[model samples]
Target: MLQETSRDPVGVLVVEDDAVTRKALCLAIESDPGLKLLDAFDSVKPALDFLESSSPDVLMTDLGLPDGSGIDIIHACARRHPATDIMVVTMSSDEANVLACIEAGASGYVLKDAGKLDIARAVLDLRAGGAPMSPAIARMVLAKVRDNKKPAVPQSSPASDTTSLTRREAAILDLIAQGESYGEVAKMLSVSVGTVQTHIKNIYGKLSVHSRGEAVYEAHRRGLLQLGRPPGKRS
Candidate 1:
């Protein structure tokens, strides 16, 4: 894990094919005082070559590239720099590509149309071990989970619920299922973002979910989505 000191910003590596999109992503990440542009590449080979020597705290890549698929870069990061937070910023929302990225250890997925701020925010949230998937991407992932029929825990196992989470954990899981960001959840719960992250880590472990989308799906499968509702049920 890269340590964050007052002297260093969060290092970011961007890999996108489109020149305009690449420039936009670079500017968005660098514009933030919290993030430093480590490097930006338009192809997978160079990015992978660069990763051979260095590992940024965050690796953001698109799905398609001239030389090859961006999933290769994601796989390299997962193997070479396991601590790095990998996010997919691409136009492809196809189920196969999304599932491939997830299996390759991507932490988040944002569409190309998400705007610069959303991209930057997704990178930061991912670095903090919070899955920052866009709403549409989240939905796609949930669809796959349903199609697979692989529940987080077996339906016949009642003890799974009893030993799975504490009330606070359940509450945190609920908020996450509702698509609340870590920062938003922190403010709502009167806790620090780090605390929220810690809870998220625990949530991921208990639920066996790698991304926010999967966590939400698992929560629903386990009948915990209703618990995530806020007071006075607006619906």
Candidate 2:
């Protein structure tokens, strides 16, 4: 159990299309004394509108909303309140949707099958600056990063000239290509996770890649990583 914050209970907003699920989520929020249900909506528009005027401590939503994808909601919350903890509570466990949500700035990913206690715990964990991802979602994320393939060489390529990486940047990319998560890389490098994330952002800019797998492929193409066996596999 977490100590009550000096502030009001953590405000949580829910956006789910299914009436029953939405009601259940509301109940979960209501049951937890540490969390307060700020608002609940069944579509994207109303949710977006409410977000524009108010921001919650946590935003949990299902991806396949009736009006639009929850990625839009994630983007909106991320843009409006950078400190807000955004989570995806959806049925889709595919790599594509998981990656999409991550790219959209979601820090927590929970499957809808999770119990109410689990959902409450996820909300509290997110409030504590933890990334609460289900075990299946965690496996999917790891698989996505570990499944990098060599990108095809283009006819007129400029990314090949990506030799501007600093020594530390290259080192960070190497660790990431080795299937190390940001937290793992941070621990290995004796740096904070935010420091690692900053370096990763710089790496992406230098490599012209958007995600971890793309960064790995680009690093390999640029000879930053030793051409070798599968990533995350120890020799």
Candidate 3:
């Protein structure tokens, strides 16, 4: 068992559309003296509104919400409250959903079939800055990394002079590609959001990409992101 620290009780918000599952989750969270249940919602709209008004220490949400995808909630929390961590507690542990959740900045991913104690422990792990993925999900993430290590198929294209960006610019682009919000990236790097914005602007100027998605795609195409390696390392 992971040892619990003496830090403040982690505040949590549960978002699940299922009545019984949501109730069980709430009960599980509340049962833990180290966790405080802030609110529970069945949809994304109210959850988003609550998040905007009062950010919890952690978010435990389902992937399929009534209003929108749980990725939206992850993105919103990461952007608005960089300090708040996110965990995905859902029934669908499909490869696509697992990858999407990780890319959406979820710190942990557990199946809904997990026992109450297991779920609570996973939440605690997330609060301690640990990414506790279910075993199958872990294998999936590893497989993705391995796949990225394989040699890419070369494509013939017009050789245009490519503008070189600084190391910082490359790092920022990599984080963006990994689905980190500007605020979260800034906090991680111990810089202001404005600084991150400036770096993003410079990155866009150098890469000639306007949107975040476009920039990330261009970075991947140019081998700027080493998908096989760890998050910060260059491939």
Candidate 4:
């Protein structure tokens, strides 16, 4: 479906775990005359490996991956390939991950439900130095921006809940925010995966959030975590 052109097409690298979505994204890139997909991967490791050798023009990745969060990939690309433009194509539209990706250097944010044509155009727009976002994401970002302009609201948490986190729990939360899987964190800390899970569960309770994304958002909001640092420095 590629159209003939004298100029080289923009190179695109896709990282999506869902098979169907990955294929569709690849096809979308291929279908565009101005875009060429350099590679596609379903997990974080291979993508990181590929990035070590090749720098694509655009990186479209999901936030959730089998090995870790896509934010790690974004951080690597942003640091290693500063010229590359980062984009997020994920089912997660939550503010925490979205803002994290933005802070991590993703200039485009689109939902998976955005059709193939839109995906291709988004890549093009991204490469053209435009920030593209799904409508909902765009609106949410605008609202967040507006809210940021307002006076700071005093942060409060229920005293009954385990709101106070231990140093280890905060460390674990930071690692999770850095996209480390439980097993990876366990290996890094020399603990069992079960123990890591228990720590994460306790972190959730203490943060009053159920999921990793929420935990990260809450922790960041409360100044318990510093995100968007160099990969290892994130946690």
- TM-score of every candidate: 0.66, 0.65, 0.64, 0.61
lDDT (10s digit) by residue, model 2, range 1-235 = 1232336789999999999989988998899998999999999999999999998989999999889999999888877776577888999987888877877768778887754447788798776545678888888776654575446454355656535677677777777655566666667776777787788778766765544544665566566664343333421
Comparing 3 and 4 on TM-score, the stronger one: 3
By TM-score, the best candidate is 1
Model 1 stretches astray by more than 4 angstroms = 1-7, 114-117, 150-235
Model 1 pairs in collision: none
True-vs-predicted CA distance for residue 101, candidate 1, Å: 0.8
lDDT string for model 4 (12-80, tens) is 999999999899889999999889989999999999999999999999999899999999999888777
How would you encode candidate 1's per-residue C-alpha lDDT over 25-104 as one tens digit per residue? 89998788889999999998999999999988888999889999999998888778766778888898888898788777
Instruction: Give the Cα error of residue 142 in candidate 1, in Å.
Output: 2.1
- The number of residue pairs in model 1 that clash at the backbone is 0
Worst 10 residues of 1 by lDDT: 226-235
lDDT of 3 by residue, 1-235 (tens): 1232447788999999999989998988998888999999999999999988998988999989888988899888866776677888888878887766665557678886755446677787666545666777777766665576545544464322345667677776777656566666676666776777788778766666534544555666565665434445531
Clashing pairs in 3: none
Worst 10 residues of 4 by lDDT: 226-235
Candidate 1 global lDDT? 0.75
| Candidate 3 or 2, higher TM-score | 2
Predict model 2's lDDT versus the native. 0.75
lDDT of each: 0.75, 0.75, 0.72, 0.75
* Model 4 quality (TM-score): 0.61
Where model 2 places Cα greater than 4 Å from the true spot, the runs are 1-6, 114-117, 149-235
